[model samples]
Target: MRWFEIALVVLTLLSGLVWLLDKLFLAQRRAAHAGLLDDGRDPWYVDYAKAFFPVLAIVLVLRSFVAEPFRIPSNSMMPTLLTGDFILVNKFAYGLRLPISNAKIVPIGEPERGDVVVFKPPQHPEQDWIKRVIGLPGDTIEYKGNQVFVNGQPFGYERVGDYVGVGSGAEMTGASLLTERIPGRPHQVLEVDRLPFVDQGERGAQVVPAGHYFVMGDNRDRSDDSRFWGFLPEQNIRGKAFLVWLNCDSITNLCKHNFDTSRIGNRIP
Candidate 1:
């Protein structure tokens, strides 16, 4: 369980307990002693519980099942999603899961090819990683010469232009930008020139097992994704990223106000 999740649970429970105890036991006592007190002030704990309970509950519900905001920390997504982009992930888009446990209890919808998803990497489950889904369950995926082949058919791509990076993404300038057509969805991807496309030692085609997905970064050569580690388990998926609400550079430094207004309110493709 994450520390933030633990904190939410603890705060919610503590506030609720205080409220209940006050309502059941303390309220009557205060009412009986109402005439004796000068100002008739409520207990500090009761006041605090009353003030915080509703706010905490609302935040917990929204963050755990509705939607949550995440800041992009890397340029692996490049042309699709740049670093410092603050994105909103739809928590219930796939299914509602118990927050910390990540156990999906409801059946909503499964991830489709080309959907941008945030999931815990199989090798490093502690960190959250976002990538575009390239292959679904039971599908064979291949990477050759910087092109992705899904189910024996090569995914089509059209050269858009040369990518000009901005802010934190300036390091990836001059990459080839292309619109990749993945069946129903067409999105932008960045391909660096002269980079190897093989997935470690496992060359040729590989089949995606049930309850798992094949994903890759839009910046093909830069991302350490399923190509390097392994498949993303369905249980580890946090949510589908759908929107970029804000973009701010220097989150760690806090020295400059480098907000990219152009990316605000942009929908994720």
Candidate 2:
């Protein structure tokens, strides 16, 4: 589990325990005494717990079951999602999952082709990664000549002029920007056409096994996606990404100067 998740869970539990113990045992004893010498005051930990328990529980429930905010840290999903874009991932869109364990409690829906999903990649299970679903289970996927071919059929691409990103993303300026029609969803992708279309010795085609998914990034050459680390297991899926709520395009500095509001509140494709 991530450090933030672990810490949040531990703190919430500890505070809740303190609040419960005080209410059941300590509170009554203090009330029985009821003297000027014994003021109606809780211990420091109890006071802190009573004040923060409600807030912490609410946050844990909302973030675990409703939606969670995540910042775009890489250009892998560029043109569609820029670096520093704060996106909301629909937790229940896939299903209700345990916060730290990430075990699905209910199977509400399955991932489809073209859905942008945040999942734990096989390479680094601890880190959360976002990528578009390319091939579903039992389907053949291919990456050749900088184009995606699913089930031996190539998807269509619509040229969308040159990609001119703002803030720190300007480094990828002038890259080929095009709309890739991945069946149901047509989203923009960036490709460096000036360079040769290479797969770095990776296979041109592979069949997605059961309970696994094939995903790729919008920035074809820049993303560290399933194209390199292999298929994403179904258990690793965290949620489906849907909206961009904020944009601050600085990594190290963080909202120091590149906080743009134009992309805020935009629904992700």
Clash pairs detected, candidate 2: none
Candidate 2: what lDDT? 0.88
The TM-score between candidate 2 and the true structure equals 0.94
TM-score of 1: 0.93
Show where candidate 2 strays beyond 4 Å: 34-36, 197-202, 251-256
Candidate 1 achieves a global lDDT of 0.88
lDDT for each residue of candidate 1 in 73-178, tens digit (9 for 90 to 100): 8989988898888999999999999878889989799998999999988777778889999989999998877789888899899998888888888878888999
Candidate 1 colliding pairs: none
TM-score of each: 0.93, 0.94
- Residue lDDT tens for model 2, 1-269: 38888888888899999999998998998788889887677779888999999999998889889998898888889888988889999999988999899999988999999899998887788899899999999999988777888999999998989988677788888899998987768889998877774464257889999999999889987888888888899999999999999998775576777788899899988
Number of clashes in every candidate structure?
A: 0, 0
Whole-model Cα lDDT of every candidate shown, in order:
0.88, 0.88
* Residue 30 lDDT in candidate 2: 79
